[model samples]
Target: MIIPEQTRNNLEFDKLLKWLSSYAHSSLAKRIILKLEPFDSLENIQTRNKLISQCITLINEEGKYSFHGLANIIPILKKARIEGTYLSSAELYTVYRQCLLYSSIKQYIKQNKAIVPDLYALVEEIYEPSDFMRSIKATISEHGEIFDIASDKLLKIRKEIKEIAASVTTHLESFISDKNNAQLIQEPLVLDRDGRYVLLIKAEKRKEINGIIHGSSASGAAYYCELLSTVELNNKLKVIKEKEKDVCREILQKFTNSIRGIANELIINQRRSAKLDSLHCLATFAIEQGGCMAHFNNSSVLELEEVFHPLLKYKSSMIRKSAIVALSLKLEEPARGLIITGPNMGGKTVALKNIGLAVLMAHSGIPVIARRVSIPYLKALFADIGEKQDLMQNLSTFSSHVQNIIPMLNYSEEGALFIIDELGTGTDPSEGAPLAVAILEHLLFRRGLIITTTHHNAVKIYAESKEELINASMDFDISTLKPTFKIIPGIAGTSHAFDIATKLGVAETIVEKARSIRDKKDEAYLSVLEKLSEQMRDLEIKKEVWWKEKNQLEQKLRMSIEENSEQKKLLLEERRKLSERVKEFLRKSKSRWEEVVQEMKAALSEKAYSEGKQSIKEIEQEAETVLKVSIYQDEEPGQFGVND
Candidate 1:
């Protein structure tokens, strides 16, 4: 929550803010975004992040909600708070527009509250001034003009002014139509001068016009004069116009008083609207950059999966999405420091800076550009990246770095993140490497979370020897003589300086001489490291292939299960139909037997006693025949039968 200004600059936090500001619709929202800082409490951060997620859901389901016509109405609202201050038509129109925007936003949230409950909660406090908005709408037109229909008195005054203006125009036309006066006129058009209608007359024949001159033209060749006949009419028109102005002023005053009565509510609404706009901007930026909110853990463990630098992904125009490789980092308990080693331009420093930037973004409630992330709630994040040489202070690079690291050491404690780039580089290898190792040890002892990039063998060995430290490296490809820009943990990296020089067209003799000058043990160590790096790359390829095969197998298994389920359902349906056929056959046989019994009973009567035995035999034969036919009709001859 307490990141130094220098650290923020190192991580390019200001540039990130500028990118966020671009998504905002109103100046007020932009201002809020530009001044954003990390929240001090986890609860606040979680709330803000949830709001952004809810906003994204709302947008996906209902399309983007419009925030157009929203302005910074705080100043206007404050001015309206004065007792007798009357806002101009344009000023009042701005407030009216904001009111309408608020209403629309409120309605949108109400309709989609299920999709974005958190977003709705955020705007629930917005005060909707419906009455005030209606008053302004009825009084003012869209072009910031007071309508004549604003009040009956104002309407009557406007009508009277219209009539007087018509009379003046008629008198002027009659005067111009006279053949005698036509010669005196300079042009056949009427000009309005100082709210008075007049005719352009020839300056030389001004004396013959018998009218009072209003003004002269720029060229002094023409005079604008009002005819004596139309003078009284012009006066009436001017008087009526003044009356209309007074009436319009009174109407505006009435509205201004209404605004002052609800000034506090308006201010509250303005703040809430600005907050909603800010959420919109944050959500839009996160969606554009493929960012997600990170889970905050109470422990000191920090994990990042497929994380990209915010500046690289969002700010760089030339870099393709595929070209920007993501970095994965994990620092857990028992290991408080991470020492990264690699050849130059291998992305070691970038990984270090990215860790710091992720922490800052998480604390500030802006989603990080990562597939997944889980970071601790850091109390402070300190980063010393890039060159710190100060020519004005005449300080050496080594001294400058030490000056910056002193505070980091003083404030280093649990829940703090320390990032140092190219550690131990501005001095002699033997002394600088030892110094960097000591700094790492001190920070680790204080339980501080530290990530540093180094090329020093001492620092790398120290990282390997301690259970509280971890060693990581950026990958380099020997075949192409280029860096892969991938960070691999649990292995110390080799610089590959001589090999790189040989590939870069350095003379063979020079490369060989440099190799020979190197210590034998050191060269052998580097050789082993190179072999280890090669093996790691091989293992990564094998893992990728294995994962692809696993996924294919899983897909096949799912299809098989679905096919089996469908077959079972079909089997059950067939059995059901067979059972229905059996039941129907039994019902028909029972009905036939009952009819035969009735025939036997009728034959047993006294008049038919002699025929009883013959009738019984016939009934038995009929029953046997019915049984055979019903069984055969329902299924195969021997497939089913009552006795079977």
Candidate 2:
């Protein structure tokens, strides 16, 4: 069956996909699926994906880090900043916005100073974005040039206002329809004084419109009166129209020059941001890859006594018994495969996942707690253990099992860890047991680390007979009627199914009869199983002791390293202090020479200069003495009081 990459489970995997959809301007989900190749739980993927989405949303919405918020947003912002055209650093953008607002408000106060009464009065006139406003904020979010143009619109408008006001002016005049009245005006014939005519002629108004024209007034008198009311109304409209016209012209002129310049800047930033984002993505990818590598690297990567499932620790509060399964015998070479034989619900599946996950976590640069685990560096990991079925292929339980196993058998390279739960269980025992043994042999030949759980006696017997394979199983406590997940080597595991059934209140007659039927032929083999089980218990204790010792040693080593680093820091500080003192001494000698000479003359009277040569020698000796004292006298750490 063809299984898509989406089949695997990661923590919040779906949410991660969604987050990636929003981020990187590309489908991050597909990248995640491709990077984290194998599957363990759909839930793991879903949860992990959700975490990523939450991280992006948290950064995009709140702009604050909760715990490792910066760690999460750094990659995204870095990606956005470098690879994204017109990408802005969120923090830097915020600062840039503040700077812009400061400049704008300052300019507004300076330019509109004549109109606004005060600071607050001007603020009242200026537009502020409302809380409910729902438009895209940053212009040129996609195109660099367009955003730049939109952002600079206000400045362009201001420039336009200056350009148009240079030629326009206001003029005042009166009209007279009577030719006799026209004689009073003299000089030129005052154009149209047609009072009722459409006020079609556009000329500069020289004064405020306050009153009405008289005598020649016709039916249009009331309309003309309305038009000529106040100077305030006329001037404001003219200014507005002129500014608008000039602004349009400026924008058209700039359109040709600014596009390529802005686009280049945007592209550069986009590439840079993408590179930074790639580094962060690589780190996360490493974590996922490393987890898979741990198991596949070592042949006998066992969590002997105190093994815990990395993923399961948070799932249940109930106490769990740890199990051990050894495939070291299978590892004749450095990497060997192990076949684990145990009953149903005997912690077999848990063991398989634990081993796989532990190795994976280790490879990811995380520490794993194990009594003793031998690990090699592995390149890839494939796990097919629990609830893996191919309904799409219309395959049954047995068919699905075979399909899953085929990949491990065919594609797995040497030094890879392959884990299977209840191997060869879906078919008849006769066929499945032999099939399971054959697969184990094939894997062994290839030197792949194979850990399989089984209930078949034939498989267990087969492993025991082979010098290259070892048998291990989980123990059962008869008194408690509980499966004591303790694993024992060189032992065949008993299912204890009947005992468990009896403890669960199965019919007494059926329990007794079943016990009687089984007690006849395999008595000798069961005896060996009991001895091997005892030995497995002892191995568990030894494993725990070894783990404690290893932890203690590691702690001591860490402490020693820290101390050494601190010592080095102290030595460097001492050297710096010494250098500073020497510099201070040299400076003091030049600055305080007069004071030193006066003090020296007072100490060595007239006799000091009795002989010219002797005086010179005495002065030289005094200078040398001062230098020696300055160098030898211990100054306080970081202090440099240079005295001449």
Candidate 3:
């Protein structure tokens, strides 16, 4: 999306950028954040926002991670990219530290990949040069010093130098201890002068020292001289020291060559790391500011719920969160323009700026400070906020405003946003109000989404008359004679100038005289607007009460449903237990019947035919009585038989 420079300045977008940059870990990341612009494609914007969201998740799951060792390695990498150029030990240490940071981040992302897949994906694109890091760690110390173990030859040379230096010191001590030469020496202590051991000797006894004089002291009373006995040892030590330096140089060059081999990978890793750092800053800032990514739609409708001016949070240290009033606005089909009317210092301009900033922030892939928001992707954003008087061009405020607006009108397109504050105010109201109406109509006809503030009653009336326009106002408290800083849509606003003046200690007589001299038609219109504002306020209170009652009812309904579900579960469990008891009772009754039938058969086999018939009859009667008793004993009161 193309946002004009003037619009960005007018909305104080740079202030937000500054806030974002403050959370960056390095200069590279800060630079990237400061130069952020709105992406032109929805896919890119969504990707950026998703990455930030993932970062937020990571921070919440694990406490914020510190990138302490991360540094801008671009300059060092550039030098390494050139052939035969070796980085200094300190510079190479910086590169190593950055590599370690990369590895740490890679591991961190891998551990939390399940929670932050998008962040993991972003880190996965960067190369992890484990071999390169191991080489650096083996060569350089954590304190940016080259270690003695860097190379075999360097170590061997250092060992020889250490032995020779000890031998040279031994020779110097032996010469000093000899009583024959003790008087020639002014002081026995040896001093290191330009990497060679020397001794202080009396200037008058210099000829008796038999040594090479390095220099004389400040008073010229003493001479610093190297003893002749240690001269050969000192020369060997000097030659070995030079050799040690050559070995150290070779080690550093070899390390630098290794870095150069992977210079391209390092460059790519640095860029990706910087981008991740920027994402971290953005996510942190969003969380601090109570922000969320707004839903984007392809339609022209714009909806904002409980939206506040983002800068208001930093406006004053004494300002509490509750002191900032959030406003809600919705512009759908046929309402292409919103005309806000209110008295001076009533926050009409603030509302306009907030809307513009919200759009810009959302388009730039930054979360907006709002409870809920859904905005269309705007092709262009043009704003005419604050005074535009151009002293350099000798143009009046009205001329400058017109000049700034002419291009906006020409470039008006579908899905474009235009925010104008105190529109058509620099010229005479008689002409400016009608001109403002005409301009608004033209912009709406071109299908541009517009939000403009005006104090002109003509513009407000014209907005009320048009189906394509909606009239809104910054709410004022009549009892307190102060602006509430709350925006109310679908109604015009009264200036309430006289009432406010009276409250501010102006004489009642002045207020009455001013009111009487006002135009009758304008006064009547303001009176209606005041009454309408009162009705709107009452309606808002009623709506809030209704919403609370509705939520309570919904909660109660959910509880009822859950209670019913639990009762059903318990009822089914009880039925299963009762069924098992019935099955056991039936099994015992069948065994009793089988025992009676066997007794009847035994009686028939032992007696005549007539006796057998009598015996069977007796058994049948006994079995029927036993069956009835068993049924009565097993069944509970009010419970039917097995069929039930």
Candidate 4:
């Protein structure tokens, strides 16, 4: 879809170019401009015309020293093209003269050591090619003297032209100043190898006023004047041209390196241009919206919400108020297949598209807007969602669906993503459901992610039977009678055929009859022998929960026992520290006692020797009393280590 042309898109593109320029080196940009110098652009009309005129004077004044390279000229040319306004005839002529002068002088300066005109200061450069040619033609026009031009007349005309030529020659110095002199001179002078003058005589010069000199009265005056000037100028031009060539060559050499350096610098400095990022985003959005690159895988699943397609951004605003639906699938036990049943216009098709688009986007490395997006790398994506009916193939929708699906079965990989919309609603559900069920079963065995929307209750039951399959449905608010666009998991709606009809304002009797029929169908499905067995298994889930609870309790008990044991070990360590303190105290007491007892024994023995009385009974009784003091022991378990 083409986005409508708008000011915004144009502005965006301009911004992009500007950003690109930022990364381009100034030198390289110059080279590019030089390459484009010959090309016509806006600048030549307005600014560059003036610049070229001025630059010619400068070049002449400075000789060839100030000359730069064509490499250095490109930027100016580009700027003129992109931003220049307009050029006038006068300005064109000025530029034409300047360019020719520059080109001519460049040659002359090289051959002789002569002073050249200040080319940079000359405003007139090479003007429009057609204008240059026209100017050249104007200088060569011939007019015979009125009723004359015999042999004497030719010699007189030649003499008259030479004097006019000398006068014009002197005016060459004023090429920058004599604007009127430029008008008097015919444009585009032609010169030969010897620089001889060729002139075109005007008839009016023959009628010259007596004793009066008019600018035009001189025959071939402009042509002779330009040639005489050129020959003299050539002397100076020879040296200037040589110097200019050397200067330009040197400048070109330096300019090339600078360009490369600048390019590298810009790339390094502006590598992350916003314009580049924006383009990347746009590309990704396009891929996602266009559903051009989606993939499916086993481990990763994408939960896509209200996703807008990018390709359609310009053509039409995508179904904008579409509700955000949560959708995802993965390869696991219960089932990778989804059975979706809803009324017409319930957005089943849109949902399918959204899923396909989101997958495509994720694989393309683009951002997706979803509450959550977990996508695995998918090997391939196969989808059969749109309408298919072809008389050429003599195939109905059902036949087409089968034809598309049966082949998929052969190539179905374990890591592929598949999207099937309206799986069993194209034909009779009785036959379609069983076929759909068989297909789902086979796909489940392949261990790939599959999402299929079906209208058959039997498919839902089949899904419920397998623990791997999870039932989900698009929510429809019965009051508003609209598909809410919200996908709710694990709840099937029984299609809400009659409920929706009632909300649609159907007659009460008709609604009642429809509900009656729907209920009967629901009852038959619910009461089926296979369904009955599953119901019985579901009712017995409480027993399973009880067993699970018991196992959890035992595990908790074991953890608690381990916690208590750790706590007891901490208490025993505290007791050991107390016992150590008690042992330290006993040791200190014993050391003091030893010192006291030794001193006492020494005094008693000395006194006994002096008094000749041992007093053995008294000494022994005192020792016995000291040793009999009260002693207490710790009440807890004893430790025999150093502290205890």
- Give the best candidate by TM-score: 1
375-485 in candidate 4: lDDT tens per residue?
555555667776777799899999988877765577546656667877765788789989988888787787666777877877876675665566566655566777755
Candidate 4: stretches off by over 4 Å: 1-231, 234-333, 375-377, 390-395, 497-519, 523-644
What lDDT is obtained when candidate 2 is compared to the true structure? 0.45
The candidate, 2 or 3, that scores higher on TM-score is 3
lDDT tens digits, residue span 1-644, model 2: 12223222312224433332232322332343334433354344333333333333333343422111112223433343343133332432332232234334444344534433333232333332321111123422322222334436645664554443331212223333435434333222222233121122112221233334332224422223212432344455456656654554454333323322333333333333332233234324333322111232323443333445544442332256443233112233432556665556667666676666555544433233443444555544556677656689788777887877776777646656667778788789889989988988887787666677887777766775565666677665766765555555545686667767887899999998887787443544554455445544643554455445444433443344435646545544554454455446445543443443344344333442122224234433443343332212225543222222
lDDT of 1 at 592: 53
Expressed as tens digits, the lDDT of each residue in 160-200 for candidate 1 is: 88888888888888888989788888898877888899999
Local distance difference test, candidate 3: 0.78
Candidate-wise lDDT, in order: 0.78, 0.45, 0.78, 0.44
Instruction: Please list the Cα RMSD from the true structure of every candidate, rounded to 1 decimal place.
Output: 23.9, 28.1, 23.4, 31.2
- Summarize candidate 3's per-residue lDDT along 444-471 as a digit string, tens digits: 8888998999989888877766777888
Model 1 residue 504 lDDT? 83
Model 3 residue 39 CA deviation in Å? 1.2
Clashes of each: 0, 38, 0, 63
